[model samples]
Target: MMINNARHSYVCPNCHSALEFQTKQVVCQNCKNTFPIDEYIPDFLLTNQEDGGEKLKNRASRFDDLSKVYESSNWGGSPRIVVWLLTRKIRYKAGIGLDVACGTGVVARSMAKKINYVYGVDISMGMVQKAFDLSQKNTINNISFARCDSENLPFGDNFFDFVSCSGALHAFPNAEKALKEMQRVLKTGGVLTIMALLQKNIHSVIDPTKRELKKSSTDEEIIEFNKAHSSMENLDVKLHRFTLAELKMITKKIGFNNFKYLKLGSVLIFSVER
Candidate 1:
């Protein structure tokens, strides 16, 4: 709806097939399996595959590195960078906030500083567990991590005053469903903020020879990667991307209004009022 057969769409969450934009097709041509979109979003949480525990566990150090530049991280920032930006837009104190799909509780910790209580939800219990360990090791207590699906959040409506999610949506099979779920649990007029990598024209300075982080021989050698440089393939998990123009149309259909944003960066941030 945002563009004329827009050249971008979500990746198949189940088989990781590239999706067709602006349409409702769940069966992957390559995998020959059928899935469905819940609400306007797709539901990408797969079954019988591996849970994200190991990935989440591994994310501890990486996520911590992310916190250092959450506001300015070029790569590996995912949603933390967006969360950092939104934290500046609204008051977090005296409210309940959710870091949906929190990897290692990085955003959850940031949320706890301003909100009375913060909940970090991810489908991977492994991720949740690591988040807890990292938070504990860092002396963070106000935040709690849980295993929950963003598509089917295990909480009541109007439960949160402000809700924030970054890289989680794109990773889901049905990002649209996850988006609706994020919108569902918030109080009326609550704030909803999201950040995701741009689908078009992404570039980074990091060496492209690896899947995981490569260590530099010296401190100065690491200076070039001072920020985690990311590309479409660099994401711990594959996800969708969007140009600001396309995102605005998608958010409108997802029931987001009063939106504002900053474009032309590796990550795009959007703020809305429910």
Candidate 2:
């Protein structure tokens, strides 16, 4: 199936210049920085040695290692619940959509049927490639994937009609900056939905034990834990689990309005308008 690459607009990460899409690469007319299109997915991340720092690099590497089996694993919770939360409030059926930190294109593929077009972006190349491959296998042509940083998106301001980030916000190096970028790319009055793990009272009691076990457990023990727990709290990574008040404060400070959220088993599914 031929992928439709013309549905969304892209800008250069360096000079923020409009990008010219080619068969094999994407060219920046102003900066002359050409980004290669590998396996039909464009690479929009800039090549700076100190771009994301070590923490970001490690997180990307972890996702890359998990990309192949990401969808098969039970890490993202139930598909029905995710789809319902992502699509229930979508007001426009033919509008453009975006999925940030789209690990394996779960949100992108799910939104494709509802929205006219969807763009999925992630920092890990392996995750992006897996998303593109899955979309091709499913013959879903209305969606596109790219490798990019959520904190610094490659699209122009006020471009998307709907945006979403699922189950990955807590893992970002700078969640606030990423949220600001999401707001910047969303058109005025566009809806922004996010699903993230929040810090709860129960987590205060369980997180410490989990962290200690994760630090001292064997590979087999870790595998057992992974099989038993499907939440982000079980992951062996540095995460900043936001409280309800903290999330509200951050979104309010970012100028998002009509903030509404639903709490489902420690996962917070929230929506705000730009």
Candidate 3:
């Protein structure tokens, strides 16, 4: 796997200045600050800052194992559906792309097959390492991985032709900041898609209603509980579900154009033009 030393495509997350890529690190031309390059993956994460930076990193380290447990559950089908939904939308085509919060690079790898180049960025180095390994093992030369924050992308403005955030938007500490950063890096007319599980308030109301119905022990009550449980089972600890209307309003607030929403299986897909 060749490391793309495209230094010009990235900038310093601190000073927002161009970077000079060295053998094992990058020097900020403006700030003169140096960031380490571990295993060819740039580390753009800051040590001390707000937004639960350290907490997010700690969680990321344990994410690989936790994700495996989740993926092995009955609700595991959601991951496959997420990949399929994103791949179908990306369509193996020629363009530069970015996958925010890309875990193990599954979607990014899939997009690499279709696009010219794809960059996958995640907050956790553990997840980024897994993604980097996937790229090398599969010999996908067009894809790269970096340990970086989504709300503070290192890439230049109007850099990518398309952007994607699948099944991870809900986990973002600041969804609006991350979404705005995504839009900032995307070129005008570029396409962006966000796939997530919308946590509906109706789910809360229905859950209690189902419990009440079950307490009655009537034949109809049992049926309602089963149905409600089936719907609730899809949720995970990391989920921050929002309705399609709520998400659309968010995209609108972010100034995204030509927004469209789709429901594929258990996930909601939001697409917009930058």
TM-score top scorer: 2
lDDT by residue for model 3 (28-96), tens: 898886778988888887554687466656655555443332222211223666676666666337878
Write down the lDDT of every candidate, Cα atoms only: 0.59, 0.78, 0.73
Model 1 ranges off by over 4 Å: 1-83, 200-238
- Provide the TM-score for each candidate, comma-separated: 0.61, 0.82, 0.78
Candidate 3 lands at a TM-score of 0.78
Candidate 3 Cα outliers beyond 4 Å, as residue runs? 48-53, 64-78, 200-238
Tens digit of lDDT per residue, candidate 2, span 134-210? 88899998888888889878888898999999877887767999999999999999999998888754355345656
User: lDDT of model 1 at residue 212?
Assistant: 31
Is 1 or 3 the stronger prediction by TM-score? 3
Pick by TM-score: 2 or 3, better one: 2
Q: For candidate 1, lDDT tens digit of each residue in 1-274?
A: 2122112333343444554543553555566544444333333444433764344344333434444333232234345455568676556478888888776666777877888777776664445666677777878766665454576664566668888886655556577787787787788889988766676433332344222335423443344344334322354654556667777777789888888887635667778888
lDDT of 1 at 127: 54
